[model samples]
Target: DHGSQYVSDVFQDEIAFLGIKSSPSYVREPQGNGIAERFVRTLKENLLWVRHFDTVEELRLALLEFKETYNREWIVGRHGYKTPAQVRKEQTAPVSIAA
Candidate 1:
């Protein structure tokens, strides 16, 4: 997240392509954004602070791996102890009709 900058058209297009929603923050209240802020903190603690990367490419790849790990293994309390990957799977599961 870039702070308070005009988001680029290309970036918006990419977000739409990836089916990600942009949640706009409320004005002048940092507390209202606690969940996202906590995630940034968690990401830094789990991935960024644990190693020194020699290059941007290395860091990018590491981040991708970290993301996969987080989705597969991280248990979120709000998700009833399920990983993010599990939640996504449940959300996308097909509905069966009773015959």
Candidate 2:
């Protein structure tokens, strides 16, 4: 799957040369890319929806803050109220294998 930026000839060529398969969701099928769409909506609603910025730098800083908070503090219902970083840490923790 490719973002709009990845649709460029250079990206397509690189993926092709690497023997990687690439496909884009059909324009009208939001469900095909539901997870990404949902994230965008969440970001807008929780971070960008009520803010106004005069410069790209300001927007960048705001996004950085938003991402840090979202990853470290925001409780997501999907993860049983754990923050994304917490859930990721739990998932990646080492597991002992029984002999």
Candidate 3:
């Protein structure tokens, strides 16, 4: 689903050309896309709200660090307190091993 920024004509055209389905969440219906909203809130609270960088390079570096830490260290309640990386590893574990 496209967020508010994707309401632009360029984004709509791109999605249309790609044949990707686009659905916008209804106004005042946060539960419709709760995961995305939660992610946005976390990003704002943890990264955007905490720092002010003068240069794009600085911001990029900070964002990279934030993403790495979030994936590797952050314990998400939704995943039973496991980091996202751990959940992905568990999901991809081999069912059978060769002798």
Per-residue error at 89 for model 2, in Å?
0.1
Best by TM-score: 1
User: For residues 8-87, what per-residue lDDT tens digits would candidate 3 score against the true structure?
Assistant: 88888999999987888777877768888898899999999989999999998999999999999999998999999999
TM-score of each candidate structure, all chains considered together:
0.70, 0.66, 0.66
In candidate 3, stretches whose alpha carbon ends up further than 4 angstroms from where it belongs are 2-32, 97-99
Per-residue alpha-carbon lDDT of candidate 1 for residues 1-99, written as tens digits (9 for 90 to 100): 446352777777788798998776666767657877788899999889999999999999999999999899999987899999999999999999999
Q: How many backbone clashes does candidate 1 have?
A: 0
What TM-score does candidate 1 reach?
0.70
Report, for every candidate in turn, its global Cα lDDT versus the true structure.
0.85, 0.88, 0.89
Residues 46-75, candidate 2: write the lDDT tens digits: 878889999999999999999998899989
Worst 10 residues of 2 by lDDT: 27-36
Clashing pairs in 2: none
In model 1, which range of ten residues has the least summed lDDT? 1-10
